[model samples]
Target: MDPSEVEFLGEKQLVSIVPNFSFGIIHLISGSVGPFRAGLPVKVPIWLAISLKQQQKCRIIAQEWMDIEKLNDSIEAEKRSKLFTKMPSNHFMDEAQMLLMVAPDDIPDADNIRTAVKDIWDLRMSKLRSSVIGFVKNAGTYAKLDHLTAMEINSIRSLLPDALDIMLHMEHGGKPTVLQSLNTTM
Candidate 1:
């Protein structure tokens, strides 16, 4: 699966809404949603919220952690913590991007939200890059690392095959293919 898809597997889709009219409970396999009423906020899934919004039945209320500052802080905290820290939602950034596009009024700091997501992604990518370098340097002596986050593993997965190939070639006394190509045509 795509790294982002894997990352968002545990996404929480809860959203708050103010419906335009009274309604009965929405039955689902997971659970029931709501007996929606106009002018009163009721928590529902993003899918339902979007449907209501599109139909002009409700206005969306964004989550508390939807702010840019909060997201940046969360990213920093995750970096500092030795263990994984739970984010507000697994797919917050992706979900927020869609929400902002479809309902910009619901999110107050739309610009900052975009910036925050980009910053967090960049920070994680930098960390991933460093970790991969460290992993490569420690290859022969490598044992198990029990602390890597799912993001880190996902970031490194694509590079692993090539790295293993290089290690195997070196162990069998072959120079790196790239070095050999330095003197070759095409």
Candidate 2:
């Protein structure tokens, strides 16, 4: 999914790149970037790296944690944990997809990244499904879900309203649920 603008822009990453040409330092609100040199590595923001890569000015080194090995470890750790574990980044898959699209050759094991990402996504989805099932089984009107990403909330948005409507219908005698209302033919 294309993440919200705020999430995408707010993601700060250290991207290593080898510049094709030399240039003076570039200043940003975050910090001063680099006085670039040909064939020398420099760390720049992911946004700036994407821009420079698009312009054919640099070869981006993928984040260390973006590798297949690291991702496998992360997924395993998450699966072993009872609670929702922190992912490498909240919108990592989105960011990785974008960067790989622009500079596939520059990233190490670009081909495997997709497969690794998919595996991690599937595992997380399974966990999420279990959580939703648990939530439904619990006899409670309200519950707080902290530490979930915005994308996670959006995924369950449609289900929440219907579930709430059904809860209300169960509490109040003979009131139509949202599903019942939607099922009516005009």
Candidate 3:
């Protein structure tokens, strides 16, 4: 019979006799060799065999994939976060570090991460100072008296001027906000 004249029957016709024969072929060949280039009669079959072999190799390699390195990197990141305080490392250094970590590819982006860190640090410091001041203010009449002896009153009054200077500096240093008003208008 001529090759072109041969017809492969569909699988459904043989369901009762050989249910698993869902595929059919006229001629099948397999081999481990070949350039099987165009203009060669055997090229098509050879190329199909090579493709099947490569696909099987890929499946085997994929099965051995591991995530150990990713796990280790995640653990290291957690440790670093714990060791470092979230406060900005002074203003300029903080900005430099944030820019390095989050380099802009395009667009005029503000360093939001740095801004957030500074804001949180400022809030925490404000709360702490307020608490300290409140405690000292409520301690007693002795807390306000200048009769506490020369050395003690000098130490207390010295802290007062520095605290006042910081409050004044913060008031004029940035965008106007309600918090700044609380500190400055007092």
Candidate 4:
């Protein structure tokens, strides 16, 4: 059969077909969410279906690599070290198990998984910034803004604009008071 004449099923779960081997081609497609089972009839070309499946797999692998690279660049090594110490290997294993606890019959959606990952990434970034600011403020012993060095003052100033921007973007008022409080406390 010519490759171009093949048809495939792109379902997330195992695809069921009568007389499975009767098809000219069969391909297993894996994505971030789950795997898909595809089959081509004798009349369809096998090569075309296989090529499409391979393309899909390549795209998924590329996306995963990009995500991992982004995560590695964004997270600080010190923070990661602290996280690893707090969570421990057993905790990571438990979390991994929980993540993969879905039933065999249930196939997760790729788009949904991508969206979830994006949301979690955003949340973590926000938390990281907040914690860093908190740590700096807590560690400084300066009693007044005048007592702070130029670099320290600049750092605090930089954080204030971003914090205010976030508050404004969220439509939360009282940004001035928050800034004043942070200035006096730090």
Candidate 5:
């Protein structure tokens, strides 16, 4: 899936919001949100929270994982791990991007949080790239990618599958089908 699609999924994750207006439970196909009260925080989907924030009807509460200290810890852990480490949220990157972009004023340490998240992302991506290069060079039949987030997997979707296909063809004593296809075209 593309980044936007991943973000769409991420938006479904619940976030805290304190609405200025009271409202009854919002019945949605996915699930139901609470009967909102003015000035009292309630949990709602990120999309709805963002919408309300944009409309000046509510304040968005940042997720716990959005904290700079926690994020920095995660970054250091990721740097130490050889394999992909578990993320605080399945959609951490997208969630951070959306919330930070929409309600920077609402979340404390927004600038530093953004920087920390970027650092974690960059570190993970660097590891992923190195793994991919090693996998390709070693002609690996398959590789375990535990704890990879959807966005991370999608980043390599276009390249890895095709490379694996070519490698599989070559490994089975057949000429690379990709090269054969190109030769035929020429």
Candidate 6:
């Protein structure tokens, strides 16, 4: 899947916002938003929160897991763990990117949080690459991807399948068998 597609999924995650204006609950296909009152926090999808933030109608309350201290700890844990560690959110990277981009002013220590998140991502990606290499070398049919986040999995979506197909072809002595079809019948 494309990064944009992953981001679209991430946009569905709920976030807190303190709207400056009052409004009744806005119904959406996903669910009802809220009867937003001035200066009161309400949970809404990231997409709507971003929209409201862009329009200067509300201040986005950063996700609880977005705290700099928490992020730093997560980075340390990821560095120490050999296997993929559980992330605060399934779409943590995308959510952080969107929230930081839209409302950096509202989130405390935005720069530090960004750096910490990047560190964690880099560490995880490095580990994932090493694991993939080992898996391919061992000719393993299955892998346990317990704690890998959506973005991480999507990153390898294209490469892994193609690599496996190549391995299969090699195993079959590179013959064009029934599994391999020609472009078109002449």
Q: Each model's TM-score?
A: 0.67, 0.74, 0.21, 0.23, 0.91, 0.95
Candidate 1 scores a C-alpha RMSD against the true structure in Å of 6.3
| Model 6 agreement with the true structure over 1-186: per-residue lDDT tens digits | 789999999999999999999999989888999999999999999999999999999999999998888888888888888888899899999999999999999999999999988898999999999999999999876888998889999999999878987898889799876555654543
After superposition, the stretches of candidate 4 with alpha carbons farther than 4 Å from their true spots are 1-107, 140-186
Q: Which residue pairs show backbone clashes in model 2?
A: none
lDDT of 2 by residue, 37-107 (tens): 99999999788888889999999988777788898887788779877667676666666776787789988
Question: What's model 2's lDDT at 181?
Answer: 81
Candidate 5: tens digits of C-alpha lDDT, residues 45-84: 9999999999999999999898888888898899888888
Q: In what order do the candidates fall by TM-score, top score first?
A: 6, 5, 2, 1, 4, 3
lDDT of 3 at 6: 17
**Maximum-lDDT candidate:** 6
Candidate 3 residue-wise lDDT, 16-73, digit = tens: 0111112223354432333333222222221232233344311111001012333234
Instruction: Compare candidates 3 and 4 on lDDT and give the better one.
Output: 4
CA-only RMSD, every prediction: 6.3, 4.6, 29.7, 17.8, 2.7, 1.5
Better of 2 and 3 by TM-score: 2
Better candidate number, 3 or 4, judged by TM-score? 4
- Model 3, runs deviating above 4 Å: 1-110, 140-186
Model 1, 1-186: lDDT tens digits are 586565354233787877879988989887898888778899987776777789888888877787767888977886796444565665655666656766788678878887777676666667657656776787753535454445555667788657866787888799557757876855
Best by TM-score: 6
Q: Candidate 5: where are CA atoms >4 Å away?
A: 173-186
What is the C-alpha local distance difference test score of candidate 1? 0.70
Off by over 4 Å in 1: 3-12, 75-86, 140-157, 161-186
